[model samples]
Target: MNARALGLLLGYGADRLLGDPQRGHPVAGFGTWALACERQLYAPSRTRGTCFVVVTTAPWVGLAVLATHLPASRTLVTAAFTWAALGGRSLEREALPVHELLFEGELEGARQRIRSLVGRDTSALEAPDLARAVVESLAENQSDAVAATLVWGALAGSPGIVLHRCVNTLDAMVGHRSERYADFGWAAARLDDVLNWLPARVSLLATAAVVGATDGTSAARRVLTGASRDGARHPSPNAGPVEAAAAYALGVQLGGLTTYGDRVEDRGQLGDGRPVSVRDIRRAATLTRQVGLVVLGAAVTATAMGGRLRRR
Candidate 1:
């Protein structure tokens, strides 16, 4: 209704229509710079990493502020920024190929296809594990790619969204468990976790609400149970809720016993029964879209309600 909500809608519509930049998204540019910075500034301690996080991400906030000065270009900038921040179509585009490969019973093809989506060793993954990983990624990325961005876009407009994207890109570039980056990536990883914290919960609730509407399941109990039983096993505070809710939504078990690197560990189960499948992967993709829509809808309502109250 208002310009802000309309701008946000147009931005999300852009994602649905345009997907990602085929060649040069701004986030890609940031990623390249971040990698260069890591190579030049990396140290075996957290202090440098902490400073790197701030130094690298702070400029985007400034850029965002500068963009605000061009009132004539405000809507265009916001729409473009939010479009870049949201990745609904690309997320499904990546996930579906894995499903198609798995559905064709081309296990090797599926493995190769999945590499584009996840960083995990696919050599050992069976079809089910591959599907499970896709579903998990879809859920977590729903938080990171859609909900987190939309939340920030609504709360602080373009600058906040840009800043959040910068932090996320930094984490992707350097955050990991490897010795070279374990210490140096601490700040990037932690900041990403902090930013995604509330958004992750919102994503989980959005996912579980969809499931409840479709299956008559109790969104609260299932989400809570899945979170409690399986959440503790996950390494991320934010990822746990998103992945757990997705598992419950699909009525499929995820996590369980799995191999990671050189270690084999039981991550326990998240949902009720059965391993994930191609069908579940499709469902997860649909659920990802639903979650994004829910976030957008909520934002519109909140903005409209706030505007009304302000007038009163």
Candidate 2:
């Protein structure tokens, strides 16, 4: 298959897998699997830890890809693996539900849900802060979770995608600064950063392109330039552009303080427009959907061109 055809196929496969409730619900299982793999492979020595995690996860990703070559069952396996790797409970869905509680003035319920979704204390968060946190998470995850995964899957096929998922899972599991993973998880964290580096930028550009097409090329240029100038300020190398582009496209501020455990991190903000609100959060989702469609269309066009060339 050509790049575009593969991309379209991958996108359709991902959408179908994500939309299916039975398959989608198992996302947590994938998370659990990744965590389990991390714990099993986590050696005390940094070198040993890195080797163990890489060796273990690589094969699993490869196996997942190989399974895609199977007959009629390949699609089901691919769908299951994708759902497990990428379909789990997201901050986006969780955020809205929590927001609803808060909107009804149920502060305590919102606080509880927020605590569950994020690792930080939410006792002191106001409604706006809660909304901001949700929006930022949604924006960042567009690169980390959705876009990156789809691109990886498209390029590398199922195995490549599975491998990406495994690395991401490892990063999420042990990538944080805590007593347990501070040293050992370093390799996994760095690897995840490296893997996501290009894809993140591509996702930002894709978002910019879509915005420019739907809005104006000037708006897209502004978003891209602003992202390039300011994205590196965020803690993550890959997360900045996605968050920045989303904020710019939606015309709202994102980023700032995020708490983890007892420590509070002051992250650089993206965009200087209005403060984030539920409407903005919804708009971000809409943008994500639009970006997905853009990607799908591009892939389809590319695939068709390739087919024509082959025929010629």
Residues 1-312, candidate 2: write the lDDT tens digits. 554354445545665445436544444566666666666667666786687567758667667756777675554564455445553235356667876886788877888887655666678888878877766766666667666665665555567667777777778777777777888888888989988986688678888988898789899999998887678778888888788888888888887888776887877988878998755656776676666556546545654675678788
The C-alpha RMSD of each candidate to the native structure, in angstroms, is 1.9, 3.3
Whole-model lDDT, model 2: 0.70
RMSD of 1: 1.9
- Per-residue lDDT over 53-156 for candidate 1, one digit per residue giving the tens place of the 0 to 100 score: 88788787898889877866667787888998888899899999889988889999998988877767789888888998899889888999999988887777
The prediction achieving the highest lDDT against the true structure is 1
Q: Which regions in candidate 1 have their CA more than 4 angstroms from the true location?
A: 217-220, 257-260, 263-266, 307-312
Clashing pairs in 2: 65-159
Runs with alpha carbons beyond 4 Å of true place in candidate 2: 1-27, 33-41, 73-84, 88-92, 115-117, 299-312
